[model samples]
Target: MLDGLNLEVPQGQIISLLGPSGCGKSTLLRVVAGLTPAKHGTVSIHGEDVSQARSRLAFVFQEAALLPWRTVWQNVRLPFEIRNQKSRKTIESALKHCLEIVGFQPNDWHKKPSQLSGGMKMRASIARALITDPEILLLDEPFAALDDMLRSRLNDLLLRIVAESQRTMLFVTHNIGEAVYLSQSIAIMSRGRIAELVEVPFTYPRSSELRSAPEFAAFYGRVSEALYRSER
Candidate 1:
């Protein structure tokens, strides 16, 4: 039920969608991911429409969504198996790099999802998303289920990954601070449309200490105000 929504994310930058519940944030992500169809409008990535750009994108859901029976390695390798775009040797090589990027130790690779902690499961999910080497990454509240400390840690991990990979990302979150901390810009949505786009003035490689700074608090307040106005 989106209403004339349009957004343009710069190459290699992260854009977060922040809003109240049922404002179509998750639905927007789904539309861009091509999981949900739009009645009108076109989604373009890297100058190509979504259908043409599908192979260059990857998505990470709120839940890890790893198969219960699969080991960590198996879960991360699932994309390659489904796509059949790479040879076994190539996939094995890529799997090693992806797992290492997400901070999975060699020993933990054989463990099933039930044996892993929530954070570990998310790491596996991110690893799975990275396996495809996508140009754009779409995330739907990927950290909502984790505790504060763990979420902060993974936030740092995600920033590091983005720095190294330079992938464009669209992240959806209800937390103002998290949205401010992670995105280059925040798009505040209301009633199925973008109400405001706020630029984050801080440079990247932002540490957790940034969250404690006065400037960060000011920006967070600004975003919160924007959200409040949107809802009203």
Candidate 2:
């Protein structure tokens, strides 16, 4: 269980929680999403308690977690269906726009989860999360299952979403490289608490070329060192 877990994400900042397996990273994320209650302390999103904050946030899990019976269009429309706060035409328009933002064509919208590739499934998952236009998004290793090339492409998509919409993000990952690519800062967690919070000095709209840069290596080294300490 999370204990004395005091953490915060600034408005519009992307922060990744980096940790070893079972370091409570996922648990911590769940707590932030208000899915798992913290045994101690409060979770405030935008200064509101977790319960009050629920409406302003969206969460994407490690797995796509789409309903097997639903098609892509149906899956992305699920959020709107749950809220039941809009007209059918309005929800359809929002779903279509969200799909476009994630790079899916109208034709692909009819495919079932089984028919889509890993990346496409993730795109749909993200679209579902974005359909509500949440102020903050909690992601739990959404790209971990994909290959490097696919992961890179998804990273680009994620950054584009962040840039265009300026949504605050709290990402959880075991991969240091992924953290380096997507996070403005990395919070290293050990046991049940954060051990260190390291800033990534790189500017946003970062390209794949940054992966090979000396500065990238330098930032990687710093985060790696922090991870090593957390492991100890």
Candidate 3:
């Protein structure tokens, strides 16, 4: 249902898709991820179409979407099992690195999804996405279900991941504060297209204190006004 919508995410930067519910923010992410087909226009990464560049990308959903029956280790390793691309040694090395990156302990690795808390489940999900060592990450409201504190922690985790790995990221969110906090630019969507693109002037490696700053509030207000106009 997108019409004339276009966006370009610069390399190694985060761009957030922000809009009201049902405004096609998630749909746009799906199209970029190749989960949903685009009837017109193209999704490309570094001049290659999405189909060609897919191997370099990874996606994280709102829900952990982990199999209830699988333990955290099993779930995180599922991509390797499906792709069968890496050797056992490489896979194990990757699993260890990804788990460490997401701050998971050895004891929690054997637990099933049912046994973990909400934040822990998200950590597993993020670790699963990282197993592939993707260059681009597509996130669809990944922290929406968590409490404020958990959400903030995960947001910081995401920032750290990007800083360390230099991966380009596209994040979809209904939360304006999140968009301002995480993105270098925010694309505000409405009626199936980008209504406005707002730049976040704040520098990266931003702390939680940035959210309480006067400049942050001013940028937030600007984005809010743009969103209101888009909805009208």
Candidate 4:
């Protein structure tokens, strides 16, 4: 992975780290999450080194990794399980809030992982991450396994959830179009180093109208150029 890297995300924005399969996008994500060590450069949230800051964050892994034995509600409440039982009501409220934010209906909560669709499983994964009211969200291609239709829907769902909650999110994705649609800024990486950080500058609720907007095309072109330069 790159050393001496400096990433600056604004207070409440969605920035996707993107590149080809072998680049350090996911590795960097882990670095930011404290899941991987920062051998050199630092990861900061609100101007503080996150490694020691005890960040209020949630990390959604590449695989949904919803413990097969747990019910959907149980999986959502997993983050709070280790805390004192006296906080169960807080846990339940947070669980309900997170699930409902992701459009999970009450009936679906009682079902086991096996009973849900792939899309539903992914939603449950996201719901688990949100149960703690995280200030930061780190997603590692959480929807890459789904069909395009479902992926698009989840993209929208995630944007809504983040916007409503005002969480800072750093998402890692290989899909360039998804990056354009979901991120306010994008970091292009290659050979374990970031080549560029391009800002879309377009405000959210980013809509389909943006697809034909000139600024969208221009920003897409710039991001494409950065990624291409990285390949060479």
In order, candidate lDDTs are 0.94, 0.91, 0.94, 0.86
lDDT at residue 30 of model 2 (Cα atoms): 90
Per-residue lDDT over 7-114 for candidate 1, one digit per residue giving the tens place of the 0 to 100 score:
999999999999998999999999999989999998887678898788889999999999999999999999998998668789999999999999999999999999
Q: Is candidate 3 or candidate 4 better by TM-score?
A: 3
Tell me the lDDT of model 4 at 179: 94
Q: Write candidate 4's Cα lDDT for 1-232 as tens digits.
A: 6665778888689999999997988989888888898877777777788866644878998889999999999888877875444576777788888899888999999999999999999999999988777899999999888898898889989889877888889999998878998998899888887788887777889766676788878877878888998899
What value does the lDDT take at residue 11 in candidate 4?
64
Ranking by lDDT: 3, 1, 2, 4
Better of 2 and 3 by lDDT: 3
| TM-scores, each model vs. reference | 0.98, 0.97, 0.98, 0.93
Q: Candidate 4 at residue 103, lDDT?
A: 86
Q: Ten consecutive residues with minimal summed lDDT in candidate 3?
A: 84-93
Q: lDDT at 220 for candidate 4?
A: 79
In candidate 4, the residue pairs with backbone N, CA or C atoms under 3 Å apart (3 or more residues apart, or in different chains) clash, namely none
Q: What is the lDDT of candidate 4?
A: 0.86
lDDT of 2 by residue, 1-232 (tens): 5556677788898999999989999999898888987777888876789889798899999999989899999999998888885698889889889999999998999999999999999999999999999999999999989999999899989999999999999999999988999989899999888999888998988999998899899889989998998788
Give the lDDT of residue 154 in candidate 2.
Answer: 91
Off by over 4 Å in 1: none
RMSD values for the candidates in order, in angstroms, are 0.9, 1.0, 0.9, 1.8
